[model samples]
Target: MGDVRAPVAGLPPVAALVLAAGGGRRLGGRPKALLAYRGRPLLEHAVAVVRGGGCAPVHVVLGAERERVAATAELAGCAVVANPDWASGLGSSLRAGLASLPPGCSAALVALVDTPGVTPAAVARLLAAHRAGAALAAACYGGGRGHPVLIGARYFGEAAAGARGDTGARALLAARAGELVLVECGDVAAPDDVDTPQDWARWSGQPGQPGWPGSLGQSG
Candidate 1:
């Protein structure tokens, strides 16, 4: 692995890592990457969410139906990481994504495909936290830590090592809880993730309804 580059003058570049490899067992084995939010695949929306938040060179980790998703999703400029052990759990995908990141990235702002409620503004908040010298940070909803956690490059190895089963970075976060910065984002975004048919219906409300993912644009 190449050495992680240090920030030159301003905020270091933060890459967005989208974990879209989950096979939605609760949704009848549907691949979460292909889940529809608006008219585009959820993965596309996820990429857009990160891009809009100012994260450059997005990396998307694909597991379930990798080929189909690669062919169908609009991932023009994003790096795709194949997770063959996706069936193992979210941790596998998280590890794969982190491993695929280039050395130029100072940090990775990890996001999930099923989180349609997470907006660019919320992502920007996490990026800001990283810019403010936080090595680890997470968005807080109602004072509870939530998705789109930002992990500094220095902790990538520990994070990948601790990633197992469906825990993702939970173990690492818990181990270094004191170092984690929580940025309140409940006002800008919802942390609810789609896991079941009911969740799908709830998040995929009518086009014009409030909190609709498509209201702002084709992105999530």
Candidate 2:
């Protein structure tokens, strides 16, 4: 809601690859990214977080609800890239996003549409780790690794070289664990992702409920 700018230091010309190509079967075939939460679409929150993280040239991969998602993304000032192989799974979307990154991107910050609670600080920490020469960086909360992962250009070819079935960068990161950095984030909301109506209800804190983070305040 305010003027968003890239972080001044410890952040390179990073591109954000937001994966929103899922079919959302658990959401009754509805596009999860378009689902409303706290007066805004879930995808919009994800985009805001990425932009707040100081990533430039954000590319959103759309498939299940292409037209609707693209229009929403365009309104949010994000570029949309179609993922025809979305039926194949997340790997296809990831590959498409990677291929769409700008030519001079020094690194990429990847986020999932369903994981709307990831914070800008968490993303910034990942970028800081990557800029410090880590091949791979991820946000970790209470020892569990979470979303909005960062991958350096050093592994760009390796990530893009994989088959379209790969859903995550696990293999690539595992092979280079010695160079991986983990930023410990105490916020549980950073890993919260919506999959079912129950999940949404819980996150939104319907009337008598208490949600993760106890209360939703500014997460930056």
Candidate 3:
């Protein structure tokens, strides 16, 4: 393993990867990116959370109704990537997002658009782990590991290679279980994601819930 030393200066450059291309099969063919949350698209909210957490050069992967999402959302500063095989599953979007990250990023912080409950605090905690010499880290809610996973640059290829079907980066994380640092974030964030109509209703029912929508992006 390469030296996982803490940066001598400020935190290393960590890029944000937002996977917002799901077609929302269970939600009646709606694009998850286009779904409204707190009067804004979930994509916008997800981007804001990561940005607020300090990740730079955000990259967004879009699938399903990519064009519609582009037109409907405010994605000004993020690099938008379109995945043609998004119908395959979440892994495609993950691979695309990772591949889209620019050079010089020491790591990639991956966020899912449907996971509205994940807050900027949770993202910051994971980043703190990265800066503290952890090469792999994830948010832990109630002892269960969850999203906005932080993947060191060294593992990007392995992560993208193993991201298949709906597994996303599960294979890589599982394979590196011993190295994975689980940062407890239950006190700061929720892991709920909008998958079905019931899930959508539950998410939409609460508009201004604390930590639900951090500073939103114009086009996250």
Best candidate according to lDDT:
1
Candidate 1 root-mean-square deviation in Å = 6.4
Q: After superposition, how far is residue 132 of candidate 3 from its true place, in Å?
A: 0.3
Sum up the clashes in candidate 1: 0
Tens-digit lDDT track of model 3 for 1-220: 1112222346568888999888777776777787777778888888888888878878989988899888888999889999999989889988988888878889999999989888888888888888889999999999999998999999999999999999999999999999999999999899988767667667776344332332223222
Which window of ten consecutive residues has the lowest lDDT sum in model 3?
A: 211-220
Which regions of candidate 2 deviate over 4 angstroms?
A: 1-5, 9-12, 73-76, 206-220
**Clashing residue pairs for model 3:** 21-63, 74-218, 74-219, 75-219
| Candidate 2 backbone overlaps, count | 0
TM agreement with the true structure for every prediction: 0.88, 0.85, 0.88
Q: If the candidates were sorted by their lDDT against the true structure, best first, what order would they fall in? A: 1, 3, 2
Could you give candidate 1's per-residue lDDT for residues 129-195 as a string of tens digits?
Answer: 7887898999999999999899999999999999999999999999999999999999988999987
Q: Which residue runs of candidate 1 sit more than 4 Å off their true CA positions?
A: 1-11, 206-220
Clashes of each: 0, 0, 4
Q: Write the number of the candidate with greater TM-score, choosing between 2 and 3.
A: 3
RMSD of each: 6.4, 5.3, 6.7
Give the Cα error of residue 20 in candidate 3, in Å.
Answer: 0.6
| Alpha carbon deviation, residue 138, candidate 1 (Å) | 0.1
75-189: candidate 2 lDDT, tens digit per residue: 3567888998898878788788888887878888989988867877777777767667776888888887777778888788787665357456766767777877887865634
